[model samples]
Target chain A: MSSGLALISIFVLAVFVGFEVVSKVSSTLHTPLMSGANAIHGVILVGAIIVASHSDNTLQLTLSLLAIVLATINMVGGFVVTDRMLEMFKVKKKPASSDTSGEVK
Target chain B: MSRDLYDLIGLVAAICFILALKGLSHPKTARRGNLIGAAGATIATLVVFFYGDQLPLKNLPLILGAIVVGLVIGVPAARKVQLTQMPQLVALFNGVGGGAAALVAIVEYLKLGEEAAEKAGAIGAAVLIATIFTVVVGTTSFTGSIVTFLKLQELMTTRPVIFPGGRFVIAGNLVAILVCSGWVYSAADTTSVMVLMGLSALFGILFVLPVGGADVPIVISLLNAFTGLTVAASGYVLEATLLIVAGTLVGASGTILTRLMAEAMGRSLFGTLFGAFTATATAAGTADTRPVKSGSAEDVAILLNYARRVVIVPGFGLAVAQAQHTVRELADLLTAKGIDVAYGIHPVAGRMPGHMNVLLAEANVPYDQLVEMDEINPTFPQTDVSIVIGANDVVNPAAKTTPGCPIYGMPILDVQQSGNIIFLKRSMRPGFAGIENELLYDPKTTLLFGDAKASLTKVVSALKSL
Candidate 1:
């Protein structure tokens, strides 16, 4: 019961933290922010691994392995694609700076 | 490693996730933030191998192989997907994650087996309920995301799919799902659980089918939250603190984003999800075939060449025609002629929020020139020409003028206030919302009919020659 209460406290605090962190995001980064959050939840890969390690039967093992593969894709693909999107934002910034510097010269 | 050490590492990974989300909120810190998240994920995954003695060394090879296969598939797809297709790709990734959570819960349930039924007292019941919630919600998120993906990818009709009695049918499906969920709770039987999963999957498809294309982003955000809650539930069932924190965080954040997106589109969350049921079905193909003022690419070039100020309104169609580069070329030519130009980006411009910014960024458009809706709205009145590239709904005057219409209350780009409105269009088709744009027929508006890319290219050449 004490552990459950601890878990509940964690859940409540996390919710508050989640809202607080993303509440001020400008609309310009909405898509990347979303994609990044999507990747973070892919930490369910840990849950998948825990289950897979404990499976005693063929069916259980197969299911756990499948979960691992899917979770991996969610975590990995999500981060990579988010990075790709953010990369474009980064590349454009450099040229704008250079053009400003050129103007100064 | 000691159990305490593993948990400490997990907590670190969770903090990294919090930082990642915080970092993503700002453009300057976003890339680094994502890197931090990736690093945290790497830490969590590596620590799992050394945590306790639960993982048999024999199963290690299979686990590694599965992860390798996932990497082989996930990395290349992420790397190679077109910017235009990013929304659907994100939806697909989210769907697979939901499926994985469901599978993990199911495997855990199977492992618990009949023994779980005996301990149907408080804690065991809680675990069983959490497991059931994970299965139902995770499956719904998985299937619902796939439907959203199909809509965005244009593999399925982007319009709302409403049958004669869709509301009733959807309601019936929901009731059936609840009933099945109850059965699973009482019996704790494998068949009951499977039935609940199947019902939830059906409910997911039915739930999303009524949502129109414009509202698909909201649906995606909602499903992401659903997946997050499922992960949280599965965490409870498995007693993993990391999953609980990460999942609850995502669930909370995703809910906020969904609300923000819906608000941006001037839509209520409830209305977006269930508007099809309450509204009367307006007839399709009632397009007023009024003769619009069509102009040539040369004429558009002359107008743009002479204009002192221009604002380019971009939409989903710009991305569809892959005209970002061509449009940028036109803008550059206009800028060279001493005409000030800026892109007016609607919040929900493309398939997703900020999608147009990404597409435009890919074409190397200066960030300063990409003005947001609120910041750009007042400038439209003073602008000489507003070139709407393959966009319809965002600039449509009907949003402000016509009440009791689908998009009446939605805030729009006031391109109508410009000296001249020029639309680059392929045809007279209504936009994704299936509503006629009255601004297209305004006397001051000139239509250039062709693929946006081709039309922009012609305009560029014409302006250069002049």
Candidate 2:
């Protein structure tokens, strides 16, 4: 099979998998879901890195460097913000909520 | 690193991305899910660093410098931004991804000259198509996301900016993008490709400028999907497995979210994109002249103190007033009196999807106490008192009763059906959709006018006095 066809197959299957995975996320988690997905696209940074590393000219180097910057921002910012938001939903273990045997709930 | 080793690493990263999404389905595992996704990114970056193709050692400082600058800007912005501004921040972050993808494709295209293109032969077809696709979609998402961020940030008018020939201008720009894409595809002209990128960016601005703020969330989600598609195109250019898998996943999920948000607003995808809610808001503002019964915070407190079951309906106003913590205090006080207090969260209650949930969660509101519109609507009839805080559109009765209303078919919280409703509002203004709420005029509803925070504070003090 052609590599193009192989890529298409991977793309189609990934689409299905994507839909199925996030379909059950409760509405309460939708914001985090979005930011999480936003971060996933940050994988584009790898592409940026490849192009930048192989750049042969000053112009190409500059453009590729810009890509690196923007992609880095997207990757770092998206993940950190999502983690912060999700942390608010976490149930902190406290002594006041401990069981009679000193085991925390 | 060998090709086989890099592929294996990419596969592991892809698996991590999938696990991350799966884990986010429940709040219990969401924090770990985020961390897992980040770990995947770190691993992917590391593998690329060790890949056989040597990026010149001299350029190492430049690459690291660029990343340091990105960290400086991105980290502080994410940490300092208020939760109320989270939607706009998300839009801005999504834009940077698209910008990066577009730049990557552009750099790759520049590396391919006429002789190189000739040597590439049939594979040149794939390269050209991917490069052109990435340029068009990525640039569009980049500029479009900026416009959405501006509208949401209130830097620009949230109302749709309509002109006499606005649709024509947008249509004309889209055609330009198409013509440019065709020229670059067939001729392989480098200049035409850049022109196509410029036109797409212009079209993006025109595309989002006319969309009202209420619709920005859907637009952001759509742009996010566009960014994902662009990344996938970039992946093809780079031949990286993780990028392909991760980008397609993001693209699909973002599309679903866009659809869900549009459905919540009772709009089709196209309609939400072109039809501004401001047009409806203006029409409804003038029609409702009926007097509403106004009450003091003490009066609302009295009704609440006597009630057995109290339901709270919060909207964007609650977020705007930064009153989630105060509202939680009132709920806590009510719970202390043995009153069964619960929250009704409309699906599109805040600026972004699940925005109200995050805001209230930050205030320590128990997840169980917060209920979806479908689940909580049924219990409203049994509710003795329903307090609406800075909410207008989500609880509006016109959605069901007035066929002529723009939001007539939209689903809303059944706050009007409760035994009594005390509305907390700044004025007699309509909601974001600009429709007059029949619920406000209902005898069972009492309007309490003030800043949401101040009014809630007074009510809390009043309950204390009792």
Candidate 3:
């Protein structure tokens, strides 16, 4: 609830937004964007951890705890799902027998 | 003086995210990227529950309720959704992101009323503005994206499904936006905020509904961008640094993807906007579309080996059979015969964009052998052969000559030029684009009915034996 904390949050968020807009024009990093952003989820985790540690107020602590949990899930689960999806791209060698056809003999 | 190990956990998660992203650039390393991201997210969330104080004591039930409800719906949906419908699924997920952003903003705003802006310390006017911006865009992305999913899945019409006085509905949205914007400037309270939120949701729905089904790819991409922006805005409100950074990346990348898809379709952004959503099927007098032509594997196989330039246009059929390796084998044999071989890739070929590319790349087809639709279409006519392995829409002559057809004006593969054409399809079923391929009946087109991989390998054998 402190004005100081609120200001820091807004400034931090704004800078990130600015970074995002700039990155939009730079198309070189298309595939890795999600991965990069996933790391930022860690920042939320850190903030929540800090808040939990700072606030004796049960309500604040609980919320921060929840935020950390959700953020971690998103970061971890998102990466897992995305990885599996990408694996679909890997051409698996078919059973040398059936998954393929023969050269005209 | 406080030892917050939670911060350390968060920092660790962040590092994972970075590694995950770097790993996702190529198929070979993408799994690593995915794993790192998941690890980061998991750690982040666990730390939140263990440390954060945002969830009120009495409202524990609310959070619990949402998790329960979300699991019920999300789990089943994930289980049942097919790979062919994965694009729509992605749209649906993007919608969830928007919904989450809006909800987060709404909850935060509710807290603001209780905390009084003056007492809430640094919650400045800019924060309020950013929060509202995110809510509005997020709400819009949510509704618009769901509608997009419906359209793509054929649960709704693919065309501009305008109603009586549809233009009036749009004008009214403008009025609602003005009213909401006015309230945000005045009362700035939760009641006014709620009304504004309603209007924002309405505006989002209005913006997307009129977009024709033909533009779903771009629309989906745009909605994804909007969700990113919304999350970024929410990050602003929450003062969550990493949230903002992650959200912005999604926004930027999604925007570029939208622009790229738009360009590939030969439509200006404005051109797509002006077109009414139209899902009207284009099947008609074509009841007489040339009688289906059939071919035996041995007969067709002989023609393939003798041909000079051969373009293999892959489709969803290949994926259904999981036949990437077989395709590669066929291509290898042809290449060895000194035949020019290339894979013609349509932008929207297969169920989702880039699917054929993923499948072919898995088969280890040389990167140089993979050609895009634009690069390959022109060469089709001069080619000695075109083996359409599960492709339909892109090669559909209807895109070129048939007006009023569902896929009219869409670009197609110029396979008509090949001296010999072989179409391998399971049946006469139309492609996802919902238009019959006139290419099926071309005198030059010989239809080989079977699993695509089987037909292709059969042809390969004929070529090698001769």
Evaluated on CA atoms against the true complex, candidate 3 attains a DockQ of 0.17
Docking tier of model 1: it is medium
TM-score head-to-head 1 vs 3, winner: 1
User: Per model, how many backbone clashes are there?
Assistant: 0, 1, 55
Error of 1 at B405 (Å): 2.7
Model 1 achieves a DockQ score of 0.55
Question: What are the per-model C-alpha RMSD values against the true structure?
Answer: 2.7, 4.0, 6.7
Q: Judge candidate 2 at residue B144 and give its lDDT.
A: 94
Poorly placed runs, candidate 2 (over 4 Å) = A92-105, B55-58, B114-123, B187-190, B276-282, B287-289
CA lDDT of each prediction against the hidden true structure: 0.87, 0.84, 0.62
- Candidate ranking under lDDT, highest first, comes to 1, 2, 3
- Report the number of the highest-lDDT candidate: 1
* Residue B110 CA displacement from its true place in model 1, Å: 1.2
DockQ score for model 2:
0.45
Q: Which lDDT value does model 1 have at B143?
A: 95
Model 2 CAPRI quality: acceptable
Residues B1-466 of candidate 2 have per-residue lDDT tens digits of 7899889999889999998888876888888988899999999987787775563433777888888888898889888889888888889999999999999998888777544677875437887888999999999999999999988887887767778777788888988888888888776656887898899899889989877666788889899988998898788777776788999989988888777777777767877776652344344556766788999988999999998889899998999999999999999899788788889999888887688988898888877677788888888888999999988878887778776565666788988788999999988877766666778889998988989999999999999999
- lDDT value, residue B215 of candidate 2: 74
Tens digits of per-residue lDDT, candidate 1, B1-466, equal 7878888998999999999989998989999999999999999888888875754444888889999989999999999999999999999999999999999998888777645556754337788889988998999999999999999998999888989988888889888988887887777667887888898899889989999888898999989988999999999988899999999999999999888888888889998898877878654447596889999999998998888889999998899999999988888887777677888999889888899999998898888888889988988778889999888888877778776566767889999899999999999998987788888889999999999999998998988899
